[model samples]
Target: MGQLMGFLNIEKKNQKERDPRKRIGDWNEYREAMPEKEVREQAARCMDCGTPYCQIGTVLNKGTSGCPIHNLIPEWNDLVYRGLWREAYDRLAKTNNFPEFTSKACPAPCEGSCTAGFVSDPVSIKSIERSIIDRAFAEGWVVPKPPLRRTDKKIAVIGSGPAGMACADQLNKIGHNVTVFERSDRAGGLLMYGIPSMKIEKDVVDRRVHLLEAEGVVFKTGVDIGKDITEEEIRKDFDAVVLCTGAGKHRDVSIEGRDLEGISPAMEYLTASNRHLLYGEPLKPDFDAKGKRVIVIGGGDTGEDCVATAIRQGCKSVVQFGKHGRLPENRSESNPWPENPHVFSVDYAYEEAEELFGTDPREYYVETKKFTGDASGHVRSLLTGSFKSEAEEEKKWDADLVLIAIGFQGAEDRLFEDFGIEKDPSGRVIQADDRSYQTSSEGVFAAGDARRGATLIVWAIEEGRKAAAAVDLYLDRKLSLLQN
Candidate 1:
């Protein structure tokens, strides 16, 4: 460790965020970068524990306890504290292919597992990570290095999302000819459309895509694998095929008046708003939340994103509904140190909503009974029941626009069926072996949400990299850098 007792001397300092009142008026990132000196001081707080659980990457109580990609958190922190900026960037890029995305989007479960967090605040791992990558880009250190020789192998990736992109990047670096097929007009599947622009600017995604292109990854946008091209064609054209299509089949709540005109899925609404912001496309009236009372169902990350999007669209009012009780202000007894801390913290969306409205927009312990619409077949109100059966209390709330932000169930079955791949009970693709990511069908492999179900973006990248290694071993009977 650069500073042996730095944890005792230095206090944790976090990056500041823009004022909610001012930030909600624009669609850019709300957080400001911390000064280099202060960030170094924050990095110096790392204790460099004997057993660093921050990079253990284990699952506990049905939730992730650390970074799934197993980032070298302590290494980068020590490097930053020692004023080795280039070394910090190189260490960060060792395991994670997209620190920019994870730095901005990941919830930082690594902090919860930090040894320092047992007493005081955890090291500002996410902030330091963002700073390293941003500085690397500014210093012209992030450049493309295309492979010197091309192998005879041709690999076709089905989706252009995080998993697909990561897999393609790894394979391309190893001299494989990789072609990514994206169904949407753009290459980034969820990163470009499902997420709101305020969280991640579209240009950041574009910049990475351009870099991938320069590295010899061929991207075919506006091409649906199952529809535009048949499974036989994919099998005949490429030596091997990897499926990285995300779990996009959203779970729906069926109830009375579900056929109302104003009700829409959260992805549809978010995609419309993103298209409008990026490509000058017109926002449909029903999808637009402007001048309407918006109610988001399902309270998680997706629901929080809906709240943020509705607030940006100039909604009159916004409320989010969750059926379970909210977490306590601090970690519970069951959630011990090194486990993921389950506590209530106001995220960006809630902060923005609280600033715009008088109170927090979250309503817990509520169950939806049915939707109530007006004479014009448009949703006007929501009928909900208390979660407590003893109370049996029913309530109603006025809503002009209703967004179903419930999480995705699994991947679509059509694509798997088209490729003759077997599926598990939950509709996830069944792998042939625990170690190898190959599917039941020969020459076909599955990764990311398609195999493990919906998960964090960090896991998706890890799965992609691992699957790429498995593909290499299957083809050449050897392993490469990705395997290690």
Candidate 2:
């Protein structure tokens, strides 16, 4: 390493972020950029630990720390510090096809496992990562490298979400003619529509989509496989099929006045909000919170997002309900360091809500019982019951816009029957095998949330890449270079 004592010489610097007052008014990304020089200095902080567990990607400290996908963190960090931009990009692309996405949205488990964090702040891994990839795009280094030879085989990927996209990208690189079928008007299932623009910009997703298109991958939008096209046609036309649709069908609140016009699922609301941004118009079955009193019923990231969105829509007031009690401000014994802490997050959304409402809008240890709607069939307020782990029942709230933020059970499986594939009892499409992702029927494969249930985007990407590897092996036993 260039400077063994560099850690002591320079203090870590975080990226510049947007002003809380200004960013809260809209739904765009709030983080600002770090100066190039400052980011390189942060790179100097890596001590080059012997094991470098930050990149090894295994659980540490009892579900607290560790990276996933095992990035070559040190190698890229050194390259970035030396100003070897292209080399840094190459090192990054070795494992991750879309560092830009992870850099923006991922919570950065690698930093949690960082050894430098023991004494003070961890190295600016996420910031540096975003810098390298963004530079790669700017420098025009991210070109489409199509396979040298074409294979006679064809592959059909269901659900154009992250897993499907990753799988399609990898398989196409290995010479297969891959086609992605998305039911939506766009190709990127969640990435294109489900995720709000504030978190991940549309242009970034479009750029990747353009590259995939130029690389000869076919994206067929507005086509539902089980409905518009028959499964038999898909099965007969392609050598294999992969599923990457997300866990989107939400759990409904079965209670009095559920049919109230203003009560809606979190995804339905978020999806409409995103659609409005993309299409420059309103959506059918839209759930706009403008001038309404909003109460979001759930504690996770989804709930936080709703609060932010409500504020943007000019909701009069907003509150987020956490079914369980609040988490500790810092890591606890059960959720120790390096295992990814279950602590409070002052995310941009929360920051915005606090600035506008004059207080943090989160309400812990609460649950909703039902809604009371106006005579016009619109939500007026919520009747709620509170219980944390069945220990006690207390607390309630009055709400006008009742948003159910409970999690999803599985994929939109309306199309599952057409493929003749088996599904688990929970409605997750059954993969052909654990080691091999093929379905019960020959030439059909599954991956990502459609197969494994709803999960992180990183995990979806991993599932897509691994399934592609398996499918590539299945097609040509000759063994292409990088089978996972």
lDDT of 2 by residue, 1-484 (tens): 5258666677877677788788767777878767788878888888777878677665455342455667889889888888888999999998888888888877787887777775667788899999999889889999988889998889999888888999999999988999999888887777777677777888889889889999999999999887798888897898888877777778878888999887889988888888888886765433778877789888877777788888888888998888787778876777655566577778877888888888888887776777777788877777767675555554445667878888888877667766677788776877556578877777778888888777667767878988999998788763353363
> Pairs clashing in candidate 2?
57-67, 63-339, 64-338, 64-339, 64-340, 65-338, 65-339, 432-438
How many angstroms is residue 346 displaced in model 2 relative to the true structure, after the best TM-score fit? 0.6
**Global local distance difference test of model 1:** 0.90
For residue 470, give model 1's deviation from the true position in Å: 0.4
Weakest lDDT window of 10 consecutive positions for candidate 2: 58-67
Off by over 4 Å in 1: 432-434, 478-484
The residue-by-residue lDDT of candidate 1 on 6-50, one tens digit each, is 776788777799999998898998888899999899999997888
The lDDT, on a scale of 0 to 1, for candidate 2 is 0.80
Deviating ranges (above 4 Å) for candidate 2 = 2-10, 58-65, 283-286, 389-396, 431-434, 477-484
